[model samples]
Structure formats: C-alpha cells, structure tokens
Target: MTFRARLVGAALAGTLAAGASALAGASAASAQAEPCVQRIAVVNNAAFVMSFSVQASNGLETANTDTYPINQSRTIDLTTTALPVSADVRPVVDAVAGATRTPSSFVSYCENGQTATYSVTGTTYDYSVTLIG
Candidate 1:
C-alpha cells in the first residue's frame, strides 16, 4: 500500500478502536447502574388486622399493604440503583385508641435480590425485621 494510504488506514483503525473502547466502558457503567431488585415480606401474626407501607425512598418507590390480615404475609416489590438501601416498614395504628401510639416501624437494609422479612407479632404495637441474603 502507498505510505499515505497506510497512514490513513492506521488513523481509521485507531478511531474505530477508541470508539469501541468507549462503547464498552459505557456498557459497563450501564450494567452497574441497573436497578437492584429487592423483596420485602411482611407477616401479620397479630390478632387484629392492620395496614402499612414498606419504603425507604432511597431511590426506590414506596410499597404498602393497605389492609393486612392476621397470620398472612404480603410481599412488597422494590427496585433501586443505589446500594445499601433501607426499608422502612411502617404499620398503621389507630389514632383513636387510648394514647394514639406512633407506628412501631422496623427499619432494615438489604442488597440486590436480598429479602427482608418483617413479622408483626405479639400485638399491633410491635414488630421485627429479619434480613436474608
């Protein structure tokens, strides 16, 4: 090949290589930014039925169980690109009952595909959270 033609060919190859490298880098970043899927299972073992919402708002939308029954579990689906995400399990408490107890929430954090189980045991005033990776 002519010298000038060889130089032009080399330049074109370098440009293509650079473009491919940049595309690969962008793909890796997009994979890292993919939303992490998490599951939250809330079991109501208490005697009375209740309502609640499970959320953290750390880049994920809030999920709720509007009317949870006794001895049953409701799973909430959440997604976020952020790591070390937190779950705020807030149960609805009757304000007219006695002193209007604030909702006893169980706050916990989980990773990608991890499951957090919150059990409402004892009474409507208490709860517990267990994280499973």
Candidate 2:
C-alpha cells in the first residue's frame, strides 16, 4: 500500500482501538457505579417490649427488613422522610416487597429524603437496602 494510505489506515485503527478502550472503561465504571447500600438487623425473641428501632439515612432510597414474631408485630419506620409512602412510593415498595417476600405479609414505605418504613411480624429480623432512581 502507498505510504499515505498506510498512514491513514493506521490512524483509523488507532482511533478504533481508542474508542474500544473508552467504551470498556465506561462499562467497568458502570459496573462499579451501583448505589452504596447499608443494612441493619433487629432480633426480637422475647415477650417483653423492645426498644425503638431507629433507621439511619445515608442517601439510599430503598430498604428491607425481616421480622420474627414472638408475641406481637413489630412496626418499623425505615426512613425518616415525611412523605411516608405516597402513590409514587407505593408501587416501588410493593414491587420490591412482592418480589422479596414469600407468602408472608410485610409493610414497607418511603418516608422521604432517603428514608423508608419497614415492619416485621415474626420474631427474627433481616434488613437490606439500596438507592433507587
């Protein structure tokens, strides 16, 4: 091939290689860009009253909790947001709860500004969370 043509070909190959690298880097970034998550666990195993369970907000929008009942149901507000499970929040909570829970009935809601509400009926408890768009 002519020298000028070869140079152009090399330039095009280099451009393509650079584009691929950039794309790969973006993919890696996206893979690592998942929302930071936090969790808390509450274990209720006695017939006596339990202390108030408090939730900590760190900019995450989702929350999960599991409860084991001893003698009563435990009501937990996972979030401190004032908007407590509005219409927009309902579907998200319902979808997550439906997919996560078994034949059990659980209550979840969004409070606002990175807070949620969760309750468990059992004596054991497991909790999880993630930030949603």
Best by TM-score: 1
Q: Candidate 2 residues 29-131, lDDT tens each? A: 5543122222223333333233333322222233443333444333334343343332122212122222232222122333333332233232223322222
Question: Candidate 1's residue-wise lDDT over 1-133, tens digit each?
Answer: 9999999999999999999999999885554322233666667666666655554434343533566567777766555323245444332332112221223343444456755555555544444333322
Can you list the residue pairs that collide in candidate 1? Answer: none
State the displacement of the C-alpha of residue 27, model 2, in Å, after optimal TM-score superposition.
0.8
Error of 1 at 40 (Å): 1.2
TM-score of each: 0.43, 0.32
Who wins the lDDT comparison? Answer: 1
Worst 10 residues of 1 by lDDT: 94-103
TM-score of predicted structure 2: 0.32
